[model samples]
Target: MPLKLYKRGKVWWISGTVHGQAVRESTRTHDKEVAEAIRVKKEAGLVSDHVFGPKATRTFAQAVESYLKAGGDARFIGGLDDGLLCHFYDTPLKDIQQNDLDDAARKLYPTAQPETRNRQCYTPFVAVWNHAVKNGWADVRQWSRPKKPKGTNVVRITKRRAGTFPVEYEHAARFIAAMSPGPAMLMTTLFYTGMRPIELFALEAGEVNVTGRWISLYKTKTGEPRGIPMHEFLVPIFTSLLKRPGLDKEPRLFRTPRGEPYEQIATDEEGRGGGGLKSAINGARRRSGIKDIAPYTGRHSCSTGLVVAGVHPHIKDQILGHAADDMSRHYTHVPQAPLIEAINKLPVPDAWHALPWLEDPLAWSGRLAEGTGRRTDLEKRREA
Candidate 1:
């Protein structure tokens, strides 16, 4: 084939075979004339390489090393990725066919949810391979990254209700009312801010700005700096928490439940991730007998509450550190008044409308739990 010229994301590229292996490269030009010139040169090079031996092909392992050397691991989130790449470690990128990629996926993620396999396996595999492609070793057009393994028709919506239970605003209020001071405060922050558990743990006292009416943050899993405006109600809470004795000791802001690092409960009982926040949430859920309650439910509850209350989506994204424009919104200077106003519009759940008080949302703690919500006496009796 006369080296096939294609455009990907505005950059023109030439695709063809060199020594029986697929190779493609960006022409770095928008003008078709310029692209055509680049394609001709690439085709000439491909012919030369085909007649002789082609450039040395890189293994998937070397691609991973290049990626890591470029500090890619810090940029994306995933574990068990190295194991996925191990399947093709020794094989040359040029020799890797779609079948080889498929076999790896089927073996490593056979019975894992297709989405899980895609993210945990194929996602990393492509990232590693892309590093090679950028260096003129592999091809994106050849063996494509499998976003979902073959024959997996359904994108299972069994969207894990795992490790968390939803909390309505009133239920949150009651849960807070019933909880110890430390847990109460912690849950309150989660409920209002929709901040992640790790972000909560990473909060420094200096990050909170009562005078500026915003909380600036840099320590996030996304590795992006954020400036979340403080809600009106949270100002007093922040003021109180900021002034509490021994606040200066830890680098992080609110060491609620005092002295213990947030991850202790996560480590001992609740398992890794979310740290003591997860344990504290579960403990409070049990203490209050609030079904399906966990730390993350607080974030969702806050988001749902805002949405239901007719708050602007952009405002919600801003408050929760979610950029609708995906990091671009982070840089746009939005006035605090509008943010606070949108927050004020977020309706608190009435006493009669509170969950657990009114109803139980689903609970899928991911640990093969019983039924979802509350069951009646006759229903329970029938099961017995």
Candidate 2:
């Protein structure tokens, strides 16, 4: 129930009550001044808890659920914390050790598909445990350091796919142009502006500023409200889509053909539980002859496009609601004029035009509509 501060080797240490039990951690600062400051902060946190009555005892699992629930609404990628928290929830926080974690990781490979298991389970384990230690809920010294199995070919096969999707803007434009009012605008907005799919989908009509050429996004991955300038190409598209004769009634910017908002697409019906953005991206990719594209790819495409066109990495990060001030990345924000000009300079190649498949509306509808299969008729004609 008491908090203590001391020095071990060169590192400053802080230890105190976590759910009325002792928990301790190194501040990881070798500098005496910095360590003292951190120790002060730790003591202050403990004092705050003492005055506030411990702010409800949250287990590792409970914290993860809370983090995800609050974070899920954010427009940014919620990192590895969610899954790790889930694993902690499934396994006892105190019982998990480095060896056990390694064993769990090894089991993921060969037995349960290691790569899938590592991403789905292992990485998150490291993250949430780290979270637990940082938040003073557990002693970092007690957690076991799970070692990588020697001679195990930890081939990181799931490497990030390299090279930007250069043709995304053009393909996006064509698909947007081809799309019946509702989806066209949604896709166009994603293509031009680098807003996360959730951020865009989460948009209410009021957040959009057609006259001012910017959109205000309240909930972002960084937990900060950011305003990004609208792409000039998108202004007309949004204005038309927003005020389109029959479309103005819906409060949301995008909806299904049947007039369902993107969020409400989940009707709890069979085979259509919560595809949301996935369904739309698959539909667009099938027609565009672009294989393996996901809805988030639009965001990636826009981000990379900006990067390629000489927009500052920090600005793109800011626009996408990324933590641009992450000193580790050493990024500098591109000024507004240069950033806008750079974005305008993106090369949106007409790659989809080369593929004749997307010309038909039936091919573009998510999951082939009936009587839309060209191969079936071709086989019949050949037989005849």
lDDT of 1 by residue, 1-384 (tens): 567888898888888875566777788888899999878766775676566433344666667777777644422222345465556776777787778777887887788766556656666676676666767776665445555445668554554453243456766676554444455566667777777766777787878888766777766544456767666666666776676555677656555444444542211111235565555555556656764556666677777878887888887887777773455445434337776676665455553233221121111111111221242332343366
What's the lDDT of the predicted structure labeled candidate 2? 0.53
TM values, all candidates:
0.56, 0.55
Clashing pairs in 2: 84-124, 98-146, 109-114
- Which ranges of candidate 2 are over 4 A from the true structure? 1-57, 68-86, 90-119, 122-168, 171-180, 221-223, 244-250, 264-279, 285-288, 324-339, 348-384
RMSD of candidate 2 to the true fold?
13.9
Looking at model 2, which ten-residue stretch has the lowest summed lDDT?
264-273
Residues 45-119, candidate 2, lDDT per residue (tens digit)?
556566653323335564455445555322111334533433345454556667776665564454654444554
Name the runs in model 1 displaced over 4 angstroms: 1-82, 85-106, 118-166, 245-249, 264-272, 324-335, 349-384
**Clash count, predicted structure 1:** 3
Give the deviation of candidate 1 from the true structure as CA RMSD: 15.5
The lDDT for every candidate, in the order shown, is 0.60, 0.53
